[model samples]
Target chain A: MTLKKATAYRLSDNSKALLIFYFVIFAVMLSFILRTTLFTSSNYGTLGGLDASSMIFIFVVSLIFAESFKMLQQNGCSRKTIFLSFVYSTIILAVVMAVVDSLTAMLMDIITSNYESGFFQIYQARYQSMRSAQHFFEGLLWYVTAYVMMGAIGFFITNLYYRMGKLLKVLVSVGVPVFFVIILPILSNLTGGAIYEGIKNFFDFAWGFSHGFNPYFSMVSASIFSVILGGLAFLLIRRAVPKQ
Target chain B: MKGIEIRNLSKSYGEVVALKDINLKFGGDKIYGLLGRNGAGKTTLLNIISNRLFPDSGEVLVDGETAIENDSAQRKIYMMGESNFYPEGMTIRQAFRWSQRFYPSFDRNLALSLVEKFSLGLDKKMKSLSTGYNSIFKAIVALATKVPYTLLDEPVLGLDANHRDLLYKSLLESYQEHPRTIVISTHLIDEVANIIEDIVIIDQGEILRNQSSEEMLKQGYTVYGTAAAIDNYIADKEVIGFDNLGGLKTAYILGEVDNIIPPELEVTKLNLQKLFVVLTNRRALK
Candidate 1:
């Protein structure tokens, strides 16, 4: 019962942020709508990247650790409850955002046939089916998986920082970028591009873009990605004590 | 069966030992005063019981359930820490709203009434509140929780005299209205002497004294007289503290008072604060 309340509060926190996101999105969409109606001869740009924006928003929201942890822990919640609430909140937020984005994308297309730039259109070649319904369903799943993965990664980063001391945190903050931006490239060059090829091949296999244009591989991979990151996050917070 | 049980609880921070093998039980719906000096491991014990910090060894059980990571067990408890755990940007009203959701037994009306009594601005953000008001706000919420066991660590850390009096009265009122086990950890023993029924004294990471307030106070006393008389009287007795000025002296003794006393020497009953002072003095520590 306590877990239920905690999960509800976590979901409500994300939903409120999601509401602000939609308000801003609608305001932007309304401006384009006005331009199209006022200047019939003018070409209005397509506005259909809500999925990407929502995914980014959720990831940013998941980066919050201190406030959420303090709030839940204050209410007599254990670390287990806090971690579970966070994971459940991420899944629920991803599902809600995916459904809302898919419906909005479809609705806007019906209202104005000039709609484009959705995930379905952006990755049309990756999907075999050309049917709009198939696109909507596939895009929905794809959005959910992407948002879940993004949320997991964001949460993992924040939890890692929370668990680290000042020196370790600084070392990690600089070491991560240095490794990716400089060392990885140098190592890839020294390996005769084998490292890059290996990474690309791994992505191809995980996303199922190589063989049958299958999205199940991406979906399964995303689930596994979330589980692993979530597991590591729990370990980091398992013995975490609040700062003075 | 219905209390917090700690068995061999120990916690250390590097070379500093915060708590050393503490075995205790806070049972039933009674008010307990945990008296200790600064860094006497009072806060550490409370924090460990609340699961905010992990102990090096031992376990804590609330009622019959382990409190380590059990939500059901935790739901029955609440600890108002010395530090502000709520988000700084959150308003008192927002906190109350969320508190209602988290605690099924939370009394929103009680919180509102206490807020009005304390004159705390409901819409003011946590960061904007003064130290006194911050303590008052958290204290009000803690009282309204109505949980089975409420552990308050430094409940009146920054309150003024008037606010402190009002808080003590309110605490008594709440305790009478709905009896629950309330553990108050503080060094200000005199202020809470009349409020707490059971008193527990800890010093240097160890449990020094744990008993009823009346019984503990009855165990010690002060004898005031000339230096020579006071020294002679306490020589055979167990003396915990002493104060001297010129030829006059005061010796705090821990034992039953004798019926026959020297005419020049005066004997006064020991108060909780004096006993606590003598018991936790540096000389008493190992």
Candidate 2:
């Protein structure tokens, strides 16, 4: 019952407005892009497109976390219930968004079937390489994982801001980038670039392990990152007090 | 067994102690007036009980179950804190609907009736209401949520004289109809003196007095007469405070009243407001 209440609260008026705004903007922009690419002679075969829906999904999920946590907590909801409800709502939102994205792509393919549009051709090639069902399901899974990761990160950052004192907040704001941008360079210079080399090597290994390797491994890594961020968010919010 | 039991609850913000080793129990189907000066941990205690702020030292139990993360225990309580917790841009009707979702026992009819009584617009967004109406909205919700225990922190913060009276009457009506425990924290002591059956006085993060209103009233009295007569009458008694205008004077005495009073002196019961002022002032002097 608490979960249900929390979920209902999260999907309140502001969230609904955000969802509508994103969908309307995506649909209008997609139509404009398709019309120009199909009708204009020069841009017909060289059609370029970006996954704008995915970007909107990430932003929508982030805004939901940024606004809902404190409001729900203030309304006498337990932190555990709020976190669990967020998980459930995020899963539902992810599936809905992914399905919409896939349907839009399929519709675009059908509209530009006569012309060999670059964007539609790329999707068709993927559909042929992997069965259409596998392609659509894999795309959905990727979106779901990516959205969850983004949402969890957003929640963690918002919780951190709430939990930090004024002095600590200032320190974090100034210290983090200064450490990497200024202190790291000086340390690298003094130590014959060993620190820089170590950092680069670590990033190289991470990139290769996640993106350059099997797609399944990258999905697992995204899931792991999401869980870690979710755990951190829970810890920060478990005992947080609202500002006076 | 059905009331909220708070055990050794303590909370602090850095060096400032908000609540210190506080142990309090709010039980039974009676109205309680939780009186405290500003910064006396009244709101802090309510927030802790509602799980909006975690206690540093101890636990809160509702009917023998922990209330921290327990939904069953939390559902029995509805706290209308001083802060605005309703979502922005939500109308009063929408708020009522969502409140019903969270608290199944919330009485929509009662809330709507209160809106009519208070002359609050159901279509007005929460953020658009005046301060007094904001408080009225929350108070209406508190009165309508027929939970076992309701904790109200500064429920009448910005209400005027007439609205405050109406709210008090509505509060009494609700309590009489559905006999639930209601704890109210407010500075308007005299206004609620007749309404609250029990009184809990907290000062400087400590429980100074906790007793029935009648019993608390018995602890103090006042004598009015000429300055000389008043001084003479209070010569042998523990006087908490005094007021003087020209030659006339009033002395607030803290203890039993004598059966035989001087014929020239006038005696009256010390009102709750004066008693609160005297007690808190005496503590400050110490």
Candidate 3:
């Protein structure tokens, strides 16, 4: 019952925001299509893809952690219940968003066929590069994995803020970037570029893992990162106290 | 057995202690007034009971079961705290709807009726409501939750006299209709003096006094007479506080009132507010 209520509450809270977001996205796309088709000499049918979806998904996830967590806890929800409900809600949101993105792509495809110039379906044609059933399912997997990874990162960051004291918050805010931008560079120079090589290699590996031809590898890596982040978030939430 | 039992509960915020090894219980289906000054750990205790905050030590049990992270145990409890926990942009009606979803026994009809009685707009968003209405909205929810143990921290905050009176009447009416343990944490002692069955006075993070209202009132008495006579009468007893104006004096004595009265002195009942001030002030003075 706790899980059910928590999920329902989260869904109710965010559903309106999601709807407005989708409506705006659709309106923008439609307006661009109309302006290009009617006013331009040549039809350049290009709709900006699901690139904005990831950012929106991350914002939604952050809202869940930053606000929903405290709200639920204050309303007698246990940490375990909230964490579980958030997981379920995020999954449902990801699936729904992915399906909507796919449907939008298909609709764009239909419109592009009617136009003299083939539509530049950014997400389907450029990003996924395929329209087969297998590719669609793979795209779905990518979308879900990307959403979960970003959502987990958001959740982790929010939990960090929620649990940290003022001193810790200030330290983390200033110290983390300073360590990477200044201290790490100095250390790399002093270490005869060994630290730089290590950092380069780590980024190279991450880039390869994410940009791999086989989407499954990227999906697996994203899932792994999501699990680590989600696990850390759960730990923080378990000990989190509501704001006074 | 059927109420909240807090044992060895201790909570501290760095150098400051919020609750200090406080052991307390709210038993039976009686109304309890959790009286305390500001920062006396009233809200802290309620938060811990509802699992919004964790105690540094000890545990809270509901009907003999641990309430910490226990869904079944927490289900029996409801708390309308000072903080606004509802989602932003949520209307009063939506809050009531969600409350029904969370608390299975929540009475939506009663909540709506209370909204009507209070003249609160159901469509008004929580953030838009005035401070008093915000409290009234939560108070209405607490009254309609139908939970076994309801903890209200500063439930009447920002309320005017008439609204507060109406809330108190509604609370009493609900309690009469459905007998349940209701703990009201507020500074308005006189307002709730007659309504509350038990009084739990907390001062400086410790339980200063915990007893039935009648019993607690019985422990203190005020003697009025000439300053010299009052001083003589309170010489042998524990004098909590005293009020003096020229020759006339009123001394708040903590103990049973003497059966044999001095002809010059007048004895009266120790009101809750005066007694609370005296008792809590004694701690501050120390």
Candidate 4:
């Protein structure tokens, strides 16, 4: 009962922001269609890769920790309940948003000949070779896991920062992106591309780019990634106390 | 056994200990005053009972169920803490609505009545409320929750006298209507002394006294006299505390008052506030 109510609260609390976000996305799409029809001779496609945008949006949403934890605790929920409710609600959020993005992408595909998405940009050629037309179910399945993976990563980062002090938080926030963007690349150069190849090869297999463009493998790997992060986050949440 | 049982519950932050090997119980269906000085572990204990904090040792049991991370046990308890735990953007009406969702037994009509009585705006967000109204808002929801065990920490932190009186009266009326366990931790002892049925006094993380309020009061008395005689009179008694005003003096003694008062000296009941001050005061430890 607690899990149900808390998850319901988590979803409803975030529904307004998500509604506004979709409103903006559709409004932009409307303006594009209207502009080309009214003012221009040719229809120029609006390439809004909504799946990636949804991933980023869910990531930011997962970063909401302090206030949600406080609210759940005030509502007489235990830490375990809070953790379960969050993971469950985010999974639901990721899946529902994936459905919206997939349908919207298909809708755009039907409306404009020039319309394209990031998913198509990555796998359209491969999918075309494998099948006749765009696969709705396959795209949705992959997007669900991908978005959940994004949410899990965001939750892990939020919990990691919550456990750190002021100085550590600053150092880590600056150091992590710096390490990934600059230091890791420099290290790869020093290692004669072994590190880069290892990463590329791993993703190729994990994302099933090496396995005949099989999306099932990618879904499995994404689920595993999400589980790993969510499990680690549960450890942090277990002993987490509400701080002022 | 059917109440909140704390066994060897201790918690610390680095070198500072908030609670120290505290073992106590708040029995069912009574108003309890959890008295303590500032930094005296009252809030920490309440937080632990409500699963808001993790104790370094021991555990809290609610009706024989562990409270730490136990949803059922936690659901039976609610702590209206000094700090706001509800989200900042939530309006009073939204909070009340959510409270109903969280606690099925929540009294919606009572909450609405409280809102009108307090003259609080239903649409005002928590951040927009004045300090007094903020306390009032929190108090209203807590009173409406109707949980089995309710811990109120500084329930009237910023209320005016009239508001405080109204809250107390409303609280008593509520209790009369629906009896349940109420543990109130507050600095305002005198205001709550009359209404509280039981007293649990904590001093520096230790349980100083735990008993019925009426019985606890009967164990102590305060005597007023001139300096010379009072000084002589208190030497043989258990002088928990004393005060001096030039040549006149007052002594707080802990024991039965079997004998009649001396002709030169006067005696009165030691109210909860004065008793707490002397009992927790460092000098009174001797």
Among these predictions, the greatest lDDT belongs to 4
- Runs of candidate 1 exceeding 4 Å displacement: A126-131, B223-251, B261-267, B282-286
lDDT of each: 0.86, 0.78, 0.82, 0.87
Off by over 4 Å in 3: A35-41, A51-55, A113-129, A175-212, B223-251, B260-267
Q: Give the alpha carbon lDDT tens digit for every residue of A63-93 in model 3.
A: 5565687678756788899888888787777
Q: How do all models score by TM-score?
A: 0.93, 0.88, 0.88, 0.93
The candidate that achieves the highest DockQ relative to the unseen native structure: 4
Model 3: per-residue Cα lDDT at residue A10: 76
Residue B12 lDDT (model 4):
93
Instruction: For candidate 2, write residues B1-286 as lDDT tens digits.
Output: 7789989989897898988888888999999999999999998888888887878888999998988877788889898889777766778988888788878888999999999999999999988998899999999988999899999898898999999999999999999999999999999998889999999999888888989999998998889999999988898998878899999999988888899999999988877888898889889899
Better of 2 and 3 by DockQ: 3
Identify the runs in model 4 with alpha carbons over 4 angstroms from their true place: A43-46, A128-134, B223-253, B262-267, B282-286
- Give the Å shift of residue B2 in candidate 4: 0.8
lDDT-superior candidate, 1 or 4: 4
Tens-digit lDDT string for candidate 1 (B1-286): 8899989999899999988899999988899999888888999998888888889999999998888878888888889999999989889999999988888788998899999999998999999999899999999989999999999999998999999999999999998999999999987888999999898888788888899988988998889999999878877898877888999998888889999999999998776776777666654654
Reproduced native contacts, each prediction? 0.88, 0.51, 0.57, 0.84
DockQ of 2: 0.50
- Candidate that beats the other on DockQ, 1 or 2, i.e. the better one: 1
